[model samples]
Target: MSGTISRRSLSSPLSALALLALAAGAVTACTGPQAASEPEASRSASPETGQPVGATRHMIDNGGHDLAFYVTQGTGPTNVLDSGGGEDSSYWKDLVPELHEATGATVITYDRAGLGQSDAVPGPWQVESAVSDLESGLEQLGVTDDVTLVFHSQAGQIATCLAQENPALLSGAVLVDANLPPFFTDERIERLVAFSQPQLDAAKEDPDDPQNRQLLSTAESFVATSTAFHRATWPDTVPATVIVSEKTPFDGSPEDVQRWKGAAESFVQAGPHRTLIAADDSSHDVAKDRPDLVLEETENMVAAQR
Candidate 1:
């Protein structure tokens, strides 16, 4: 925990242990924060509907800071695509139009605080803040009900909190290779924090780096946040579809892999409308590896809602 973190602890330019920190609902910097002073506005008139296929970007004021949102025009049952740790709204760029075209549902994607075009707030990452951003952003967008939330990885924590706090706002959800409360057991959280410590320490070297800043933010509140998350539960009334990748985020460790998949299984089993689908030939990033599967499941969920 005091030295260089092993690659097996996580991966990539963010840090060797970013995934571990990410699963713990900490260290959200995958590609770090980029300077996005203004939201880019782009649109192309669609041939079929004459509506804009490209996203109409908006910089919504959430408290004092701005959270960037890309909204595609369509009908009701708004589909919101939220990215994982270290990612921004652009992560869903490829899937937005496809979803909108298929379901004729208003598609939305946004950058979390500290990522993409959004303004970053100082201090530790708070799930409550994340939930507030979504709630307020939707309210400002005039999105009231029948919302389908599709989220991945670290965004799962936000989804969990949202379901508990604002279950009335959502019609359904699609969780793609997301971290679950069952996976954040006490022993698992201890190991995750331990694995993430070295990376957290390394973050201090380049304190100004946005990625490091995010990693550092976790140092103060990761354990507390993750501990609280472990005891949190998704409402049984909210129907959910869980897509679990074959090679989980912890594919490097067989023990963790089983636990990860087990969590998804347990989650689905605990509820009435919950379903689990296996992404047979994918890794932790199932959306990228098997978007067809993700799309299929999401479309099914949306159809069920209608």
Candidate 2:
């Protein structure tokens, strides 16, 4: 998939109060490595060509949370990764660096607020607030332009919001097993409420319990409360690629797997500048379960952009 953002355009600066509100809203909303060997074996056959690899890990203050990200520096547009629901940035631990090494494009992965090292906001994890936090975090990292966002699962929605409001900042987006907006139906909302009730009840019982608070701050509840906000704010245009998982659990039926894949495929087909790939060997956690596949697909996408 190919998409473009006009570099000639400029983003309106956020007012100080708006910035503070973004920060404050964020504050009130939520509440990897590798090694190598077999050098001689590689020498037996010509060594495989690969891009130079360089990565740095750092913590950035986003709102009240200390968000952690790994920046793999290279040429051209940077790839910003968004983790799946219920996962930390480590979701891309093995795959991102490989993509960077193979493609020579900068790759970034971060823990969202309330996940990993980042602290949770107080209440209502809205998508708009999340997008603001992302924009601010990217600004803090000095990566304010020419970005290729790679979003997994529910993050596709947040990425769409960012690209819509600030198209100049994004070059492209890849949605991996992404959750689309229109998919948020009343049945899904009911399911989310059912999924979040226990945690919400626990948090109500004892707000001081960090564990309970964290559980209550799940992405499901966050999406439920913020769906309207997302619906109201649509972007002008953004390029995207969508990937679907084809494998299933041992106990899962073929029909169940197909149903899940169908949902993902629908989202991909619905978007402009989108392509869908069904990874047969992988399940939901494609990055972790099939890093090679993730790396290969990412490299292909980045190369196409070039």
RMSD of each: 6.4, 12.7
What's each prediction's TM-score? 0.86, 0.69
Query: Residue 13, candidate 1: how far off, in angstroms?
Result: 7.4
Residue lDDT tens for model 1, 158-256 = 888888877888899999988688887887777777777777777799887766766676566677777787777889878999999997776667777
**Stretches of model 2 off by over 4 angstroms after superposition:** 1-54, 195-212, 219-226, 229-236, 247-259
The residue pairs found clashing in candidate 2 are 28-123, 29-123, 31-121, 164-235
Query: What local lDDT does model 1 show for residue 247?
Result: 79
Candidate 1: C-alpha lDDT? 0.75
Q: Write the per-residue lDDT of candidate 2 for residues 1-306, one digit (tens) a residue.
A: 112211121011100000011111222222111211223333121212121134455566655556655566678878888865456666566676667778777887776677665677777445677786677667766776778777776576676667667788876777676555554445444444443454455456875454444444443345445344325333435666667766522114444345446655666566567677776667556666666766776676677767
Candidate 2 has an lDDT of 0.55
Residue 34 Cα positional deviation in candidate 2, in Å, after optimal superposition: 30
How far off is residue 136 in model 2, in Å?
Answer: 1.2
The TM-score between candidate 1 and the true structure equals 0.86
User: Cα lDDT for residue 69, model 1?
Assistant: 76
Give the Å shift of residue 225 in candidate 2: 3.2
